[model samples]
Target: MSVELWAQPAMMSDPAPEQMMEHILKRVGDIPPLPVVATKILSMVNDPDLEVDDLVSVIQKDQGLTAKILRVSNSAFFGLCRTITTVKEAVVTLGLNNIRNQVIALCARSMLETRAEGYALEAGGLWEHSLGTAFCAERLSSTLGLKGTADQVFVGGLLHDIGKSILSYYVATRFQPILRLVDGEGLTFVEAETQELGFDHAEIGARVALRWNLPEALVDMIAHHHGPSRESKNRTQVCIVHVADAIASMLGLGLGVGGLENRIDDEAIAHLGVDDQVVQDVMVHMSSIGDLRAHIGIN
Candidate 1:
């Protein structure tokens, strides 16, 4: 449970990577904490007796967050016929959980909006890819009948690659060594990152999820979206994100330097009790990724 304890050891010949690992772990704390309002909204939604007015009161304290939520609520993203002018109206129209997704989505954007140029993602590329994965994961959970709030998988999918945002600087500085492991030794980008940097983005992402005090399932999803561990308790959620990430990459949402390098694991496919046809259907439905920027309100 110790976030700072990494499994990957630095190369024996190189003391530098150990230093880098220390530096990387220290940097994880520098990333800001999850917004208090967003966390409060998450807590309030879990209360069965929670009322619309209660949720509205918590959100209204932050004028900017409330305004953006209302904007997205009124957009074609929801396909509502009536306009939503107030936070209460948005809660009623979109439902409490949907409104919760908007808050987390925008908060996630603060971290994800950066260029993961280290991963060959520039400007808004990381955000686009993360949003697509979140939507895909949400639909996959529904199609598979996984029991959880819509907010959980959506948040999971959205933040899966968040480590890339934080690790970009290390990746940029150590690009040559990481690349050599991948191209010369045939290591996957993640493996190379772990070997060279002493941790990969997924591990860093797990730390972020833990630091934010996000749900355990979300921590697992972000930690293992690339390849779910066999021992993970939240296997369904973790695998959904793994498959969703692959589907997002396949749809060409945000290939970055990791483009097509990542593949859908057959075990994850089987674990979800789905065949290729279901995968194909999900892919087709997810093609609505075309209007993603509008859905997320990111220009």
Candidate 2:
């Protein structure tokens, strides 16, 4: 959704944070819609009978996106023996799932690239953090023997903090208080947000996903990425993103104001069956990748 959907809170001598959150929710309609191509790709990816040619046709509809797909297909990350010169060839070579993720990343780049000054993130900082989390989540998924869900976990990690983008305006207004709580009271970012704003970014992010008509599994992951949700049916995905976020923060990829203050959910790690060895392997792999921005086309 577009940043325009972030409604300014009403001017009042003393308005409750709950009231402010209600206003924000009502204005969700003002958010920009997802690119039609991205939405179509998401739908097709979930279809059991999706055809490669059908996906190729959809990618071809946008020449720029098609080129991006081909470029990523040939990037050093893929380690292709030859260049992929066409959408059909890229889809066949990279597989539909990888193509779908690339499209999602491209579509989300604009929105995620915005500077979240309220959260103390400089321009492109949030994007860098999100992309790092996407990579980490995908790797974690594979390491946990859930390779089939690597792409889905990547999307979950990519959009985990999206609520911050929407709530940034209000956060800017409440920044001082939030910071005070974080520094003085030793509260986590989510705790501070809930105490000062009557809601956390995770909750807001879930609403955003619902507004976009995203799949329920994705919505749940975005909603509970910080920890497990009793309401979430896909606990594994939620845990994957949760652990991935912790890993990203630990790596200091783009840790803004309260980014480093987050705690790793021990239960989530255990639930995903992630051991110390897995964590070690992920850290080493991340270091070896070097300049993830280039691999993800952020630059």
Candidate 3:
């Protein structure tokens, strides 16, 4: 109790996990808010009444985001016959859903590009994994007929691991002990995290999403992406992100110190009505991962 828990989370030796959650929540408050333009674009997904003009209007407010949006829109991935000359043209040609996905991707690149010190996620490692998962989630939703826009599913896959960004430092300090829980006791990475740090990254990720004012569904997806609870209200959506995260791991996108200790949830598979073959097809189809990096991740 005497130690500065928040200031020195890395140095703590198995302090109270319950108390640690309180401090972790407070520390996450220090993470900067999402760009206003990014926030408004997400709102468009929630508000059907918001038209394409409204989308263009908010995106144009930030010229950097606007340029990135147009550049991505005209990429060969979309196979546009003509160049996208403006934000409005990009939105109209590519459609609002894809445009929103681009905005979120750019925001995710900014937020996830940092090296998570504890998880040993090097520069671009986390971003690469996140983008891979986003591609899988968006694809899986379509293959399963999940009745949601690609961006809606993409949001969960992309940000499911956001909590790791903040927890990296704390995990680094307790890495040896946490690894003991995994190696000696055979716990998953998340179980070790919760036992040692009080809350796992998924729990902290939900808190971060909440702080960013992300939609409840998206927040819930991040919350249960690791292991969906029996009582979870958003099981279907969580299953999509969970499965996508597992697929990303299988592809070895960004395992870092987390490694392959965590197994994919079978319940998630059943909920989405998918099997290994379906997952395999999705993995094979993830070739366009670089297309996104070119538009958003690359400076």
- Tens-place lDDT digits, model 3, residues 1-299: 11122325543455587667777777654556789988777766656576888888899999888888877787766777888899989888877777887788787776687777678888778888888788888888888877564566688888888888767777887899988998999887788888888788888889878888888878888898888766777778788888888888888888887657547787877777898778878888875454547643344
Per-candidate local distance difference test? 0.78, 0.81, 0.77
Looking at model 1, which ten-residue stretch has the lowest summed lDDT? 1-10
Ranking by TM-score: 2, 3, 1
* Runs with alpha carbons beyond 4 Å of true place in candidate 1: 1-19, 43-51, 76-82, 147-149, 296-299
lDDT by residue (1-299, candidate 2, tens digit) is 44724546465655787677667778776767677788777666457678888988888898888777777788877778898889888878877776787889888887787878778887788888898898999999888889867877888888888887888877888888988898899888778878998888889989878878888878988999877865678888888888888889889977987778666688887787888899888888788888876666435
Clashing pairs in model 3, backbone N/Cα/C closer than 3 A: 17-198, 118-168
TM-score of each: 0.87, 0.89, 0.88
Candidate 1, 173-219: lDDT as tens digits: 67999899999999998889888878888988887677778778888
The candidate with the higher TM-score, 1 or 2, is: 2
| Cα lDDT, model 2, residue 223 | 90
Overlapping backbone residue pairs in candidate 1 total 0
Task: List ranges where model 3 is wrong by over 4 Å.
Answer: 1-15, 46-50, 74-83, 288-292, 295-299
Worst 10 residues of 2 by lDDT: 1-10
